[model samples]
Target: MKILIVSYYPLGFGGAEVSMKILASGLKKLGHEIIFASTGHYEGYKNYKLRNYRKIPFFFLRDNLLGNELIKIINKERIDIIHSNGYYTSLAVLKAAKKTGIKSVVHFRDYALACVKSTCLDSSNKEHERDTYRHIFVEYFPLRWIWEFYKWSYIKRSWKKIKQFDLVISNSNPVKEKLKSLGIESTYLANPVDLEERTKTSVKELRKEYKIKEFTILYAGTLEEHKGIYELLVTLKDFLIKNKVRFIIAGKGSSYFKILKYILENTIINAKMIGMKQHEEIMRLYKLSDLIVVPSIWKEPLPRTILEAMQNNKPVLATNVGGNIDLIKDEYNGYLIKNNEWEQRIKELMKNKSLREKLGRNGRKLLEEKHDLKKISKELEGMYKKILIKN
Candidate 1:
């Protein structure tokens, strides 16, 4: 089958982009021809071509033009299906697929379909117990009703477009359930990782390269408020000073400058920021970590970091929310606790090498049994074929 994969960017370093690339390769290996229709370019995918969308003041005109262009590509390429990965590219792809009478698939990797805040967190960076209209209105003020109405309008419009697709996939059960609540039925499929490839880095060499002389805890994600960067810093500031440990923070965002300023002003000597590192470099860092911390204040669909850490045979300490609870069984594969209890958890793990090793081993076992990429790829292949036959 000739498939056109639509995405916001052709090449990106994010988890969704990486997962799509891996999926494309697996499909290609299965003898399917893949063509990319995106706004950006990457050298590895030879069939990549830019399809720029229109900006504000000309949104509908741009979408119409893009949809027509996609229709042209579908006819010219004899495309059998269109697979879109992000919200920005879904409308044009689905419209084109409908026009050409070809099947279309859409993947929901995040909470954008139902929540305007995306993280599903309130102004205080706490997950709302009830995500109802009243709760949303009361959380954000000034013109709460206007914003609330706008979110409803946006989600309703999005759902109308999304319903056009033949198949919709969600990366986690929580996201799938969230979509179901909005009257959108979706297939649940968890994200997968290449276990062997992810742990290829030489641990000894990495330790030497990074000058790792102390027990290290790694945090690799967007350095933002929603990600609990500020909360993490505050919780670990005094603990880091009193203990023989190192905290390595990676990735940059709006909170990067604020974190840097705090670190400098407070003289958090044991903590260090490496900004952003490529996937391979991140894997190497994961290899050196005694434990990985995912301090997200929001409900993450599923973070690739947790899987990667587990695959590398490292115990994960994550907040008790979203997919974190799904992966970590307290005192089993990993620890799931509140953000405030992080200091105590870290100290306990640091003081007990046997406990750390046991948790790490269990985490790897969980990764192989459930989150391996090969198994997930086959499941996806089946889903695609099923959709094709059904249509």
Candidate 2:
């Protein structure tokens, strides 16, 4: 199978990038010919070079112009299957596949199609409201609005073209449900994690490096508000003052600055904002922490960080939303707190080291059973074969 994988961003960071790198590499390992196309270079793919397409201003390019370039790529590559990662990139593949008569598969990694804001929830995460807006409004909206309108138009104009694609793949049940609500049927495929690399960290060394004298809580991912970084910081601040614990945040984002600001203003003592580190370094942090916190306010499709933490035999303390509910078994593998009770929950976990160890063991078992990269990759490969046969 000659597969053409397309993504809008570099593949070194973010959930989408990690997934694509795993899929492309896995496919290659399975004796499939894979060609890559993406917007930028990723540090992870330093050895494997990708063919670069002429960079076009995403906001300024009209629909037809974008479609034409994509069509040319499909025809030129003689691509057998077009696997697109993001929304805009998927649209381009859909357009190109139609013109070139190629089969296409779209991976709906987020809730971009259903919600106007694309986070799968209203600004408040309560109910659908018409005037709801995205958090990064200046960076996304107006352009996003235009893109949304264009997508609608393109779907109407090329309904057959768009629908001819073999399948729509989603990472979680919540994401698939959202797609179904939008009249798009999708298959659920769990994202893959590099379990081999994750399992190599020495827990003893990690604990010594972080100076973890007491129970440590870890949060690894973007510090964005949507990810509930502020909530984690607040919870850590309160939890630490009451209990013997420390919080280590390993990742950087817009909310990193906000967290720094909060730390400075309030003189937060227990929480440490270590900023972004490489993937290997992050794994080491995961090893050090006794528990991992995923306090996302939004309904994340499937957080890769959660999977990573679990794979490292670290217990998770996550908000009960999105695929977190799917991954976590309350009081069994990890503690699932209500969105509002994050701080109180952290404090409870801090006081119970036995519970933390139990949950960590359970989480590791679950990761080995379900979230293993090779296992998930084989499942995805089966799905790809099924889609190709159907098409």
Candidate 3:
């Protein structure tokens, strides 16, 4: 099968980009010829390095010239299936695929369509402003605004074109539910992780590298307001100061500097903000972490950070929202704290070392059973084959 994987950015970073890389590589490994069509080039994944794969620039956003050129590639390559990740790129690919009469599959990785605000929140970070002009004013705004304002418009547009494809795929149940509410059918697929790269870092080495003397709590992912970084900081500051534990925050975001200043001036907790380390370094942080926290205030689809932490044998403490409940069996593998119970839960995990270790072991077992990349890749392969056969 000749497959074309469409994505907006390069595959060096970001959850969606990494997912495309994994899925494309996995399909290629299963004897399918894969080509990555993107707006820009990814840093690490050179075209010559991949098997039965090529990365082509479509430049769909740059005046639609690339979209027409991509149509030419689609016909020339004799592409059988077109898989698109995220919203903007999916819209473009769906358009091109419609013209080429190729099978198109749009994979939903976030809540881009369901929420009007699109962050799954009513407003941006600082204001906590709900139902503001930004939320209500929906006309002639920038591309970002248009995407969020008329998400349903694009969604309906894609749906019209999607009839050419065999299926629509979503990474989480919440996303699938959203699609269903829109009267669009979609298949549920788990996001893939490179388990081999994740498992390469040893716990001991990770601890030593991070200088983790005490029970270190780790948080990775964007330090945005919707991610509940501020709330986590407030909760962890009091708990960690009392328990003498350390906290390390990884990843970059709009609120990174502000959060850093808040920690410096307001809290005495031993905290450090290591902004956006490499992927390998992030895996090491996961190994060193005694517990990982995904304290998203809003409903998240499925966080790759939580999956990576679990795969690294680190217990997770996430907010009881979105697809988190599906991944975490509270008290069995990890703690699913309610919005109000966050501080109490952190304190409880801090006090009980045995409980933490038990949960960590259980999480590792769960990862092997359900969230491992090898298992997920097989599921994706089956989906690809089914779609191909149907087409």
Q: Please list the C-alpha lDDT of all candidates, in the order they appear.
A: 0.80, 0.71, 0.71
Leading candidate by lDDT: 1
Off by over 4 Å in 3: 40-63, 124-135, 138-159, 162-164, 198-201, 267-269
Order of the predicted models by TM-score, top scorer first: 1, 3, 2
Q: Write the per-residue lDDT of candidate 2 for residues 1-391, one digit (tens) a residue.
A: 7777777676445877777777677677777777667666544332223343345434225445655766666677677888888665666677777778777888888776655456745445553412223433433557576665554344334334445568888888988887676567878887776666654646777677667777777888877768988866775665566666677887878778888888778766777788877666777888878778888888877888888887777788788888899899998888788756766666666777787778888987887787677887788788778867773
Cα displacement (angstroms), candidate 1, residue 307, comes to: 1.0
Candidate 1 regions exceeding 4 Å error are: 10-13, 51-54, 57-59, 128-152
Candidate 3, lDDT over the whole model: 0.71
lDDT comparing candidate 2 with the true structure: 0.71
How many clashes does each candidate structure show, in the order listed? 0, 0, 0
Kindly provide the TM-score of model 3 when superposed on the true structure, using C-alpha atoms: 0.84
Q: Look at candidate 2 and tell me the lDDT of residue 288.
A: 79
Tell me, by TM-score, which candidate is best.
1
Name the TM-score of candidate 2.
Answer: 0.83
- Per-candidate TM-score against the hidden true structure: 0.91, 0.83, 0.84
Query: Number of clashing pairs, model 1?
Result: 0
Per-residue CA lDDT of candidate 1, range 1-391, in tens? 7878876664434678767876777677677788887767544554546555544335456667778878888898898888988666677788898888999999998787766666677777766533566666677776767757665565557787788788899988778877887788999877777765755557777788888889999999877788887788888899888888999999888899899888899998988998888777788889999999998778888888888888788999998888788888889978887647888899899999899999999998998888777787778888888888983
